[model samples]
Target: MSWWHWLWESEWHGILLGRWMVAVLLLVMGLGLAGLLASLLSRFFYLSLGKTQEDITRRELHRLMRPAWLFAILLAVLYSTLHVLEFFHLSTRWVDWIHRLFQALVLLALGLLGSRLLAVAETILASRYQQANEPYKLQLVHPLFTLGRILLFVLMGFLVLETTLKVNVGPFFTTLGLGGLAVALAAQETLQHFFGALAIFADKPFQLGETIRLENGTVGTIEKIGLRSTQIRTLDGLLLIIPNKRLADSPLENLTRTPRRRVLFRIGLLYNTPETTLQALKSELEESLGQLPFTIEKPLICLTNFQDSALELTVVTFVDPFYRAGNSSTPLSFLEIQDQIAERILRTVRRHQPQTDFAFPTRTLYIQKSSTGLDALSEVSRSGK
Candidate 1:
């Protein structure tokens, strides 16, 4: 017989060649149809969920759907393979192994899906916080989401071990506990900072973009808060990394939180100046300060003390919060505003009382020289008589 005819007519293990070929064809066709159906369903589901969502989220969902579709197709193939094996009287051991492998794969896919969903949720939450102008809450998103993802994957791994490999997790956990303790001891400092970061978030001593002074006298603006440390940009433009533990434990002054900046000025007038002139100057200075746009509070002007060489006048005022440092949009800084105010006071004083002089340290000496020899002798004889 011809080879083609022999192949068509041949029977192997009580199965005809043509029948076996048909079964193989049906398996291939079933798998392809099942995969196509899964893909269509996944696309439909994604479209339904993402119809009103952002394009970015839609794209992420599309990517997530691909794996889900792949997993579905893999499950279909696994089921078909088992059906074929049973029909062909294959070993039960192989079927059991395949089932376990499929279960493990499903668990892994579930972990990935959970992580993707968490990422999507985080993205949504971050955007909402940004829109609401609550940036401090946004800072907690990444670390918290990452920790959750880690936990999810760890749980999935344990499930795979116990369910698929039929491994006992009781002893594993005991070993893990001891190992975890060792790791905790090794990373003591890191753990301290990690907990300190949590405390900072909870306590809210300072926040991002706030100017802070540390207990150690380091002054800087908070740039970033991280898992282990905080980044600070100093006034001199240097970046400072402060450990979270120290930052949380130390006294921190949040300079930006104040409603206004206080300025104290000392003015010296000549000691010979009249009290009336001093009072008039003080009144004029207070009036001028009241007119200034940067002054948030009424000025206090008084002669605080009588110094050795000058009349000490104390002037206290507050700069508006808008004019404080770190407001780049405002053309004047706190120091610049103080300087302008001081100059204005001087100019006003000069214009109003041109004769008034600013004081300087000066000393006067009086000496009465003894008279000439004849006059001194005559004065002494008169006194003796």
Candidate 2:
């Protein structure tokens, strides 16, 4: 017998491909057709997005790349295998089970592929925004992408279970509600944070890139606003992850949103400073503050307090909140501005009264104790020495 005839007619137990060789050939042809379809679809997708093989990225990011093509080809091969079995055993009871299993596997594959595709899209969008220097749009993509992924998996989970396990999703979800009560009981904090996130979005007290201060004295720039928490980059370059619930419930201040920044400080001089020198110092400081481009409105300079060793003059000024010191090519921030202001104050104080000194805390001991107590103190001191 010819080798082809021998192979075709050979039977492994009750199974033979003698007459079903035609079915095998058809199956091969069907797989080829499926592959051709995938190639054409993927090529069309790449071209539609105005991407070419010569692009910076070599990977076919428009989806339906080689892996996806192989994925589809594999599914097609599995499907053909099932049909090939039907050609030989047309009344097999297992055929329906095979079909159901195929459906479930396909759903699983689709879910995973969709998730990766979503991630790819997100990466592409973020890259584009970053290149364009639109960080506001870039930050927005992360949270939105996260939300989309969650919804995708939830929906895909239902479809997969309904197909594979033959579970009725509607009734399952209804029963799940009762079980969810216990789950919710255990995750009350997570739920609170979730709702707080919703509140943040709705109210928009602050946005990404704005500076905010919490009542607990934490100051930082808003970096990310996620479903459960917020990320802040503090001035000292530390990253703080704060729960959304606490952020929403607390008294928060949006520093960047203010119209002006108030600067208040007390300048102390020796108590022996003459009244004329004090008045002159106050007048010049006020004039200097008003002439500054950053400061707004009349500054208040008054003799507010008399400390133990010095007289205190409180200086209050309202500066343009958005001001960045323009003294140099690179503008200075709030801290730098504060340093410069201190220098200016020192110069003014010196220019007004060269001989006057700034005060330091001092104490004078009064030795007018009773003679008996003094004698006892002297005796104790003599003994100690």
Candidate 3:
């Protein structure tokens, strides 16, 4: 008999083919129903949640729905597989293939669903940790969550390849290591910058909106904190780009961290001023600084120097550091403060020591006369006064 006629005449083939077709139709219908239900649920869930809710919560709920989808698909596959097997009368060859395929699909589904569930759990946990009363702020929690995400996705990828694709992980890992090494070599500087950025974010040497002094004396307000660099706006209205590696390694002075700015300075006066005047000058200088709106009291002013030509008084005080360095109302620059202090000193000195004069270097001119009376008479006769 011909092979086609033989196959068609066989009782087993007839029953199995008929049952297989029915099972296929059933699986298709089941999948359609499940998809419709899942869609409706997802739509309702999303609509109820609203756009105003936190992104984390929204993403987490979506991730959590993945398991429900997997379950629906799994039920359809399982039902279809069973019916196909029974109809084929337990044919070992095709049955084994079908079993392995179902097993692979189940593993893949579980892996994907598990990953989504883990993501949802992680989001929920992170949000809870953020809200909890803790010693560290929410900034500290970001790194942990990021690390968790990386690890989870890497693990999920490995599982899918190993269990579902049936690939050997050992040699794959070896090849991955070599590939990673090459990539590391090619992007060493970029990697360094990335880690440097991480260090900056973790250590917080300078925060957003804080004033910082660079090693090279560039003082600016940090306008942006990016992954690779920081952007700053200077007092001169110029923007600065500072690399993350340099910022991580360099010594930075954060002016905003301190509650008060200590000003240690000296004011000079004419040495001819008396001790009583010097003492009075010191007290008045202290009082004057105290009267200034920004300067903190009680000011410490002392006659610190008794130079040959001038007296130097030391003034130490604190001020509000937030005051702009060059603004009109209480400029924070060293030169401006010195000028203000100098003006105050001159006013005080003028009021107290009206006769006292400032000292300056001078030379005396001498003319020797040959015979005092004769030379004087000859010179007086020869030249005009």
**Candidate 1 backbone collisions, by pair:** none
- Encode model 2's per-residue lDDT on 15-99: one tens digit a residue: 6666366556756776668667666766666666564233324244534255665676678666776565553464555666777
Better of 1 and 3 by TM-score: 1
- For candidate 2, report its TM-score: 0.69
TM-score of each: 0.73, 0.69, 0.55
lDDT of each: 0.77, 0.74, 0.66
- Model 2, residue 75: what's the lDDT? 80
Query: Best-fitting candidate, measured by TM-score?
Result: 1
lDDT of 3 at 150: 65
Model 1 / residue 59 / CA error / Å: 4.5
Instruction: Show the colliding residue pairs in model 3.
Output: none
Residue 141's lDDT within candidate 3 is 49
Model 3 spans with C-alpha error above 4 angstroms: 1-137, 140-151, 158-169, 185-212, 220-249, 270-277, 292-294, 306-310, 320-385
If the candidates were sorted by their lDDT against the true structure, best first, what order would they fall in? Answer: 1, 2, 3
